[model samples]
Every structure is written in structure tokens, then in C-alpha cells.
Target: MLMTTNEPQSILDRSGMTNAEAGALYRLLTWLSPSFPVGAFAYSSGIEWAVEAGDISDAVSLRGWLAALLADGSGFCDGVFLAQAHRAAETGDDGVLREIAELAAAYVPSRERQLETTTQGRAFIEIARAAWSYDGLDLLIASCGGTIVYPVAVGIVSAAHGIPLAPTLHAFLHALASNWISAGSRLVPLGQTDSQRVLASLEPVVAATAGRALLATLDDLGSATFRADLSSLRHETQYTRLFRS
Candidate 1:
């Protein structure tokens, strides 16, 4: 049975969010969920090679690797792109949005890395358009043209649906960290508790990365995680592999 209430106090919680805000939050949760069918699990973002190379054999090392990624590598670069795309879409500036999308597509460091982001990017656009779209989501995506980078796709969708960028950035980074941590868990064969510990330890790194990305401009996009980049390249020819990248 459903109970209807006219009182805002009765319907709303201490957070004081209106129904629109609450619904927007729910959409973010759904779009970024691990089971959202974007094939995120198929890509490890180089964790597979990191494990094989013994760079991530334990929780502490795993945390460190991810911290670098969040602070200086794809995490930071992608976040910048995401923010740019979000603001561009929010302002109805397709020119800026298209440029950001192109940069993200060209920013990948390896063949498989490009495959990983763009493949998921295409899937996210198609899935969201089919099930969760607004009037402008498809238009923004179509305007961007060519291969849509995943972060750009996410940013566009977030803006199109009126989801605020701060929480969206945090959630997006958190989800990326979670997926990579999951890959690390399987490859390192870590106990479930250890995996949780690794993820727990990355909170500050993710928060700081999201904060930087919130203020970042396209000019700030770059990466210095050379070893991590090599891992993605090495994964291409590794004798045995379980991840796409």
C-alpha cells in the first residue's frame, strides 16, 4: 500500500532534498552501479598485468597503485574531461563538449586502453539512451560525434538529467576505484576482507582526486604514472591474461 502526503516535512528527510533531487541521485546510483551492463568487468585498467608483474601482490601496494592513478593518471585526466563535458552540456555548449570528448578518446595510452574506455563509452550511451534518457541526452551524444569516451558519456548524461556535478564526480571516481579494486582482488587472490580494506584505504585518494577534478580545466589534463601505463601495454602480449586491459 502507498501512503501519500502533502506535507514536505512528512515526505522529505533530514537531508531536505526535494523529490527531483532525490530522483536525480537515484539515477546516478543506477547509471554507475557495477551491474549497469556497461561491460566494466571485462576491463581491468591494467591491474591484470600489474598483478602478473608483482606490482600489486598485496593490499598496501594495490592501494598505492590506485592512489597514483587517482592523483596523476587516467583518474585525474578522465575526471577533468568529465567535468568539462558536464559543464559544456550544462551550458548547452556543444563545441566545448565535442572537444572534450575528442581529447578523452585520444588520451588513452595503449590500444587496449582505448578499447576499454571507448567500448564502455559506446555501451553507456546506448544503454542510458534506451532506458534513462531525457530530451537532451541523445542530442548531446549525437552532437559529440564519433567514439564517445566513457567519462564524457557519463558527464553528458549527468548534465542532461540535471544531476549536480560534485556528487556525480565523486560517485564516478568511486565506481572506477571500486571496479579496479575488484579486479585487483581477483588477480591478487586477496581475501574478501583484504579487498575491502584496500577499497576502504582509498577513500582519501578518491576524495582528493574528485576535488581536484572539480576545479580542473582541460589545460590540466596529463598523466605521470608511467609504470601503470606500461602495465597496460604489457598486458597486450602477456602469455596468459584474464582481462581485456
Candidate 2:
């Protein structure tokens, strides 16, 4: 039997490839920056509903809710969408990209969720195009023919900029989880330290999820019955809500 190493040792060994290292850093910083203007702060992704419903009123429930969402719902959906978008962009198929965008757009069950995906997605693409100046990115923007979904924009920009899918997707998932956790902290009135502890506990989930998502295909884009969707739907009618979605 023979064993093989899958590491990019050759690429890591090159000292003159500072551009590659810088590019990765830049992408990471941009994706994680609170100022990226993805409108992530405005939408709680149904967390507000969960909090109001008392489903996630404490740190324990908050952690559990977030974990389930990341493991079974949006995390999986986004992973598949990201991969499909990457493949579409790689092939330079505008139709495929549009289809991918539509599929992602339709996956969200609630109107609020749909709005969040499209709104953040369009902003993300516009910002990336204006700041990064990548080749295929412009084509993707034009091909959108309308507003692009968030996962699709992420996939396109990541692939166009030569960023690996795993890291980009992982960062996106982590940021999402972090945003929810931040919301939980505010809603549950959990201390800042407890929030950090909860986030630390999610590190393993993020790492394992990223590895799993790397192997995921379009066939794997399904959601579990988490009740969060129902919460989001109900949020649309909630009278005195602090968050948009």
C-alpha cells in the first residue's frame, strides 16, 4: 500500500511567492471585516425570532441552535452553493452561474432569509469588484443580469481571485456563526466572556464543517427541519422587532 501527502508543500516552500501569501491574507481580512457592508448586522438570520420565542434565550440554547444551523441547515446549503458557483465561474458559463444564483436564492424558506441572501450578496459583489479588480469577477457581475445571491457572489469572487474554496467557505461560515453568536449575546444578555467561550467551543465545528463542505456536491444541498425557517417566516409579521430578519 502507498500513502500520499495532499499538502501543497511546494507552494509553501517558495519564499518569493509573497503575492500568494498576501492575497490570501487580503481575502481573509476582507471577508471578516465588519465594515465589508454585507448588511450582516441588520439581519439576525432568524435568531431574533428564536430569541423572542424563548428557543434561544440562554447561552446553552444559543450554542445548540447555532450548532444545529451550522451543521445541518444554512452551512450545508451555502457549501453546496459555493461549490456550484465556483464550478460555474471556472467554466465561464454565465447560464450556470445564473442558475446557481437562482437556486441559492430560492433555497431560503423565509422572505427575510431571501432578502438577507440577495441584499448581502449584491453588496458583497459590488464591493469586491470595486476594490479587488479581478478578471472573471466583472463578467460574473454582468452575467447576474440582476441581483446575485450571497453564496454565488462569494463563490465567484473567491474562485476568480484564486482563493481556495475551503478557506473561503470556512471563513464565510465562521463569520455567520460569529454574527449569530454576537446576536445571541445581545438578546440573551450573556456576558462578553461567555460569548467568547461559546465561540471558542465552535472552532472544532467550523474546522470539521469546512473539511466536509470541501467534499460536498450539488446533491448534498438539503436542509434539516430546524424550525428556524418557521421562526424566520413568523418574524416577517412580528410587530416591534429590533432586527430586520
Q: Identify the candidate with maximal lDDT.
A: 1
Note the Cα lDDT for every prediction shown.
Answer: 0.91, 0.81
Write one digit per residue (lDDT tens) for candidate 1, span 1-245.
Answer: 99876776556666688878888988999999998999999999999999988899898999999999999999999899899999999999978778888888999999999999999999998998899758878779877978898999999999999999999999999999999998988888888899889888999999999999999888888899999999999999999998899
TM-score of each: 0.95, 0.89
Candidate 1 has a TM-score of 0.95
Name every residue pair that clashes in candidate 1: none
RMSD for each model, in Å, please?
Answer: 2.4, 6.8
Kindly list the per-residue Cα lDDT of model 2 for residues 13-116, writing each as its tens digit. 56454558667767767866766888888888888888888898777888888888888888767877887788778778999888777777778888888899
lDDT of 2: 0.81
